[model samples]
Target: MTRRARGLSLLLLLALIGGLTALLWPAPPPIFQTRTMPLPGVLAARCDEFTPRVEEPAEGVFVAIGYDLANTIVLRTSAGNVVVDPGMDLARAALARDALLARSPGPVLAIIYTHSHIDHVGGARAWISDGPPPQIWATDAFTGHFIKQYEALRAAESRRGEHQFGRSVGPELLPCTALGPTPDLDHAGSTGARMPTHTFSGLQTLRFGDTEIELHEAHGETHDQLFVWIPARSVLLPGDNYYAAFPNLYTIRGTSPRPVRAWIDSLDRMRRLAPEHLIPSHTLPLRGRDTIAAALTDYRDAIAWVLAEVLRGANAGRDVDSLAASIGLPPQLADKPALTELYGQIDWSVRAIYGAELGWFDERPEQLYPQQDAAAREVAMMGGPPALLREVEAALARDEPRWALHLLAKLRAAGSPDPSPELNIRALQTLGEQTHNSNGRAYLLEAAIRLRRPVAPFAVAVDDELRAGLPIDLFFAAMGARLMPERAGAAHESISVHFRDTDDHYVVTVRRGVAEVVRGEPLPGTPTPLASITTDTDTWKRLALEQDSAAWALLGDHLDVDGSLLDLRRFLAYFRRGA
Candidate 1:
């Protein structure tokens, strides 16, 4: 065949193949397609006074309630009233309803929620006029999970809150930062959630006041998220995932670690519909599908970018601090208004990702082999409660309150059933005073108080005993972020901690407010002969952290494991915590 004929034939074949490809692998669905998400004109454009356009919302008036971090949509129709998201605050909900009535025509017929977060539920009271409120709509599991997070974070915050938001009661505490565009009555670390009273699942559409609203389940930021679409207005409310920021890959304020994958998919859902306008609660509204889609896509990409990079570091065995420092969004994402790093930054988010994906392991050889603090201390001659007390004094003289803290620790570990409890208390108080950061102050203060706070002996209070001696991992993880090279030891430990999972793991066998690792176990889980030298988490922490293993054995217990006394000798040769 001639060259021209051959080229024509190839072109025909290529055209057929292209047609097949288009059918087989169509372009992904646009985020705006979820519903004809409208522009922020009638409602958002005038969100300031931020109040309503009219004195009373009449039938056909759609009012948006400010739900703190979420938005609740309310519709006033001739058939009572219909509301979505009820909002996060009752007062906000009332204001929104009042504003809608001011502008529109009737009463609320029904109320709907996009998800189960407390911010979404805060405004239910606003819908309730006299007796029963509008039927509350939510995922079946929404209320349960909402309550669970509420309880967990509520308790964990009191102790762990400072690290999350860096707030405390004293002068040493850092002033609250402008974490977001607007300030909140409830601090970042604190909870202002109220559980939702209703629940639902799957697709649910309701017709009221001449308008119909469609609700679809979208699991993105939270498990029980509900994405609503109004076909009439072409509006899509993507909730938190499609927010005007990098989407908080990890909320620094500390909630359940979100599913990085789930978040991406949610954005994809929003992307498919290609909504014309996007109105999220936290930031100003967005117009044009191209802009909103770009924002949502970039938001997804930003979170994905951070997650992938942080995972790369985690895979490379990087510590939390290094991983945090390494995470940064790309230019495409960094400049997007919706992808701003307003609320939660990538650093802490990366660490939370690390915690979620890879717990406490860096997979390095040093980590595989942990130094036995109690055993090493026994090998060293750093005993004598009084000598440690003297060392504490010396450290204090040098203005190294941290070093002084260590010496006092040794004295406490020596378990001198003497009047020196007063000395330990004083050392802790002094260290607490010297701490500059909120995290450091709270942690050191808590640690010192735990040590000095009078309590029964170890045998009597096994839990307290075990607690007095914190594990190396936990200890480092706590003080890890607050590391001052001159004061604290290495953030990462190349030590192996082998402990019996059962026997009061949290307590370190305290006797008369003294930490005693009375319960011991073999290094290797062997059925071999009698070896009463079981190391506890605390003893291991001290031996690994403070170089006081030898002293620990004197005050505690010790015995050679699988390698016999010879292996202990290897540890003795490499041991360095003791000075």
Candidate 2:
């Protein structure tokens, strides 16, 4: 126990601790700030519990299939078999049919829908058997949601709309705080169900032989949703009222805001039932009464906690961004398996819930007023896009990448075919290559970098991101991105210019027609052109969008023209239908 001996002992202990730390320490690698191709999806359905296994069906009655993200639920009885929320009818209908057959060979008795989501009801095709058919069930909203499939998809579609939401999640944007269940590949069978045949309101229970089923209607995930509970077995089937992962308070694609308070209360109602097992329509089932109940309780608290924090922060005058960043799960609950951000993030959910309860505006005057176009103002201030590109290039040279990136977006907006003396549409290709955040919007923005989508022959859609996250009404977004509304009022002209390879850069001029090339500036005394243009990228987009006849009038005077009538036809055709 001498001082020198103690010091040596401490050093030995430190070494041991270091070795243990290396073994146990877990942290994600350094974050990447840029977005790239092959963008990410929001959430994968958690099916760890349903790993291919077989248990003898309970005599008299057996529940053959459990629900997952893709399909609905189908249960079996000695007399007959019933299906709920059958999946996509056209594509995977057979798979769902086979799953039901595997469960039991019995007559098709009845069909029910917990709610009327497509996943809940997409597989109606399989229900057509040789015998008496199953009936369909759903809420009144079921019919409306069915008709508005395109609109309802906006929530799921945000997974694709990378550009508008800036969901081009890079390393940094990945959910790093906690990891949810990542499933192994090789899962098969009708874990996915089909659309329902019969829908109802309030609570309805049916006893198929000994099969006692209760379907209760609630509003949270969707407008008309029914959760099923089996009092006999202490097993409850709550539609999306509780996804194994956190329920989405607000989906990113878009939807009417769900009630946060209702969502919390609904989750609470399930916990109190204390089922021996709880089955989610989309995720794995919960085993054991205590575990199932506890998970559901924590879920209730998680929702409540987020809502409380969000409302508290909003009442305290915190802005949306500030509130979003501040609101998160309590640490004790954060580690819970069921409380993870698989389908939904606490931050987005909190902000969305807060906005839903309140309004989007934070009562700030600066947010209300008209705002100048950031691109046009910058282009004019910097003497045009040429100077802007020069500045961006200089930043790149100095290794100021963040600044280069910030400026790149502005330059792109400015270069929208500026047809003036200071025209420059360069820097995009280089920026696209060096970009980060491989999410969907980033890909389109990168494509916007080239003024055209990446050359199709060279670039097949690398992933869904190329088209994902694109506005559902992208014709409108394309108009905005490529438009200069003020100057181009009713000004349409089309002329072909044989852009010649010039001394320094390409020069385009009207050869035989009269049309104005917009978003570009005229350069004096240039011999050859690299690319010819009768109209600029934006004007072409605008006139094409408007289908303005004035475009033909501009073609009357041609400053430059080349190729045959067929080529012109082809060009026009390409403009009408995006390549």
- Local distance difference test, each candidate: 0.47, 0.48
Q: Per-residue error at 567 for model 1, in Å?
A: 51
- lDDT tens string, model 2, 1-579? 233332222221111000000000112231234543322332222322433322222332333233222434556665787666554332344555666567667777777766765445545546657788666666655655443423324223423333322222232333211112111111211122333445667777788777787876777788777777778777777777876566677765456777778777667777777788676666556678888778888888888888888888888887888888777788888888676665566777877877787788875677787465867787789887777767776876775655665676676676555432111223332343343222222333423433432221110111122122222222222222222334334433232232132212122222222222323345453323322444333223233223232224244331222333333333232221221
Q: Which regions in candidate 1 have their CA more than 4 angstroms from the true location?
A: 1-71, 76-80, 150-154, 158-198, 314-321, 368-579
Q: Candidate 2 — which residues are off by over 4 angstroms? A: 1-71, 150-197, 378-579
Top candidate when judged by TM-score against the true structure: 2
Error of 1 at 537 (Å): 42
TM-scores, all candidates, are: 0.51, 0.56
- Candidate 2 least-lDDT 10 residues: 16-25
Candidate 1 positional error at 221, Å? 2.3
